[model samples]
Target: MARPRTPLLSPDRIRDAALTLIDAQGLAALSMRRLADTLGVQPSSLYSHYATKDEVLDAVANRVVREVDTSGFARGWRDGLLIWARSYHSVLVAHPNCAPVIASGTQRREQFLEMANSVHGGLVGAGWPARRATEISGAVKYLVIGAASTPFGSGFADDVQVYLDRYPHLSQAHRLRHEANRIDHDSFELGLTSLIRGLEPGPGQTE
Candidate 1:
């Protein structure tokens, strides 16, 4: 007689497999059949969990977002925003293949909205008006996503130098920096700090 099949598959497991595939082979390589093959299951079994590829992609995006630990940022608004941005950026950079999926998916998940509301509440408590708080949060998110999407390869510096050589003004700016020493994290910190500073109230302001 044939051996009985294992019942280890779940929505979470399927999503995990999908994320792994994305990290290893890029999002374009993710398909129901492909995922099933990776999981050692029948392709049709995935439909019982995720209805379509789009749904799978959405789950993958959510998985990436879920990787961000908000506990460390719960202390204050500014600190929370910075922590979230850095954490999110790190996750996206580590999984660049899934970055595009994250960029396109709508953050409609309850957990996601709860996190947003928590951040928004912090800003509101810190003397920011409701509408302005929302706008500032949106701006920070845009900056984080934009920065995470930047492409940096092993040859990126050489390529950038070559391009700058064609533009005298750019070359001048590039020459000021020590190309042998890179501080990408410092650059991210500066940008994040500047953005937070821009959101601060000037002079006397009322809540």
Candidate 2:
């Protein structure tokens, strides 16, 4: 058979296979043996591409982080922050199983580091003090991480009686689980807006 234009195995294919496995079976399912099986190759093949599971995970994380948009920084710091947070949240929500790895810091991943540099640089370029700029980055990261940690609405039980008896205030809470997506999204929007709005520049600073 003629050699295929695309190689049977490559970093991209490995990363994608890892992602699919994690998405279906959670992060623990990722391993050289399992990944090789998924790719229809020998475990040794994966070793040639990635030295260890962590290396593969880092690559997978970089791939996901690459999808987050950093172009909003050009619009303005506030808009950039909002856009970045929303985009990050959307990506995490789409890949809940992989969110932990992505949020676990860049781990020397160039793409993730580049994204971090843009956010910080945009803030400083917008006249934010260096310390404050760092703080803002940390804050937004925490917010996005928290929001993606667990779906908010899903925390509530689907049974109306769960809240109706003693906690009258939460009478409608039971319905929230069914509307998890909408509620979680709206809640994130509210939190992101509130957080960003509170970041007014200090004296000698620019908004």
Each model's Cα RMSD? 3.8, 3.2
Worst 10 residues of 2 by lDDT: 198-207
The lDDT per prediction is 0.73, 0.83
The residue-by-residue lDDT of candidate 1 on 38-126, one tens digit each, is 98888888787888888888877777787775554456666777787788778877888887777766778655676677767767776
Which candidate leads in lDDT? 2
TM accuracy, model 1: 0.79
lDDT score at residue 131, model 2, on the 0-100 scale: 90
Error of 2 at 26 (Å): 2.7
Q: Which candidate is the best by TM-score?
A: 2
Model 1 lDDT, residue 121, Cα: 75
Query: RMSD of candidate 1 to the true fold?
Result: 3.8
In terms of TM-score, how similar is model 2 to the real structure? 0.86
